[model samples]
Target: MEAKQLNIGDNVKKFRELKGFTREQMADYLNLSVSAYGNIERNKTDLTVSRIQQIAEILEVDLAQTLNFDASQVFNITHNEVIQGMHSKVENHNHPDEYKEKYIKMMENEIARLKKLAGEA
Candidate 1:
C-alpha cells in the first residue's frame, strides 16, 4: 500500500493489541494519559517525530514498518550511488574462490553480512 494511504497510528494500535496490551497499559508505558493514547491510535492527535520514534522503540519495530512507510522510493533514488559504493567495497574484500563454490559457507557469509548491515550482530 502507498505510504500516504497507510495509517501509522492504526499500525501502532494493532501491534500493541497483538502484543496483548490495553490502551491504558500502552499509555502508562509511554507516560501518556489513556485519552491521549486513544487519540494517537485513532489519528485524532498529531504525533511528532520524537513521539513516533518513541512509539517505534516501544513497539520494537522500525519506523518504516510502524508507519508503513514506502522505503523503496527512497532507496531507488539513491541506489545508483550507494549500490556502486557497496559494489566497490565488496570487490575489494578478499574472499576465497573455493568458498564461493560451497553453498553452505556462502549462505552463512551472506547472513552475517546482512546481520551486520542491519546492526543485529
Candidate 2:
C-alpha cells in the first residue's frame, strides 16, 4: 500500500485524469490560463490552501487529502474561525476601502509565507 511521495500537484493531475477532465477544462473552471494551470499541476507555483480547496472541490475529494495532510491537523489549520471570517469578508465585499486594502496586504504577506514554505521563493 505504499505510494510515491507525490506532491499536491501530482495528486491533482492523477485525480483530474482519473475523472476524465481535460487540462483546458480545469483551467477554464479555475479562471486561469492553460499555461498557469499547467504550472500549478507541475508544482512550479506556490500552492495556496484556497487554491487547493478549489481543486479538491472540483475533483470531489477532501481538501486534506488534496494537501496530503492529516484530516485532524488540516481541519485545525484550515477551519479556524478567524481565517474563515477573513475569507467571508473578502468574498462578501463588505469591507471599506481602507480595510480592504489592509486585508489584501495581509493576504499577500500570507501568500508570500506559503510560497516560502513551498520553496517557490
Using lDDT, give the best candidate's number. Answer: 2
Per-residue CA lDDT of candidate 2, range 1-44, in tens?
A: 99766488866875564444679877877889999999988989
Off by over 4 Å in 1: 1-6, 69-121
By how many angstroms RMSD does model 2 differ from the true structure? 16.7
RMSD, one per candidate, in order:
16.8, 16.7
Judge candidate 2 against the unseen true structure and give its global Cα lDDT, from 0 to 1.
0.63
Model 2, residue pairs in steric clash: none
User: What are the models' TM-scores?
Assistant: 0.52, 0.52
- lDDT digits (tens) for residues 1-121 of candidate 1: 6445657787787556433357876687678999999999998887888889887666555677678733232222111111221222111213333323333454577679989999999
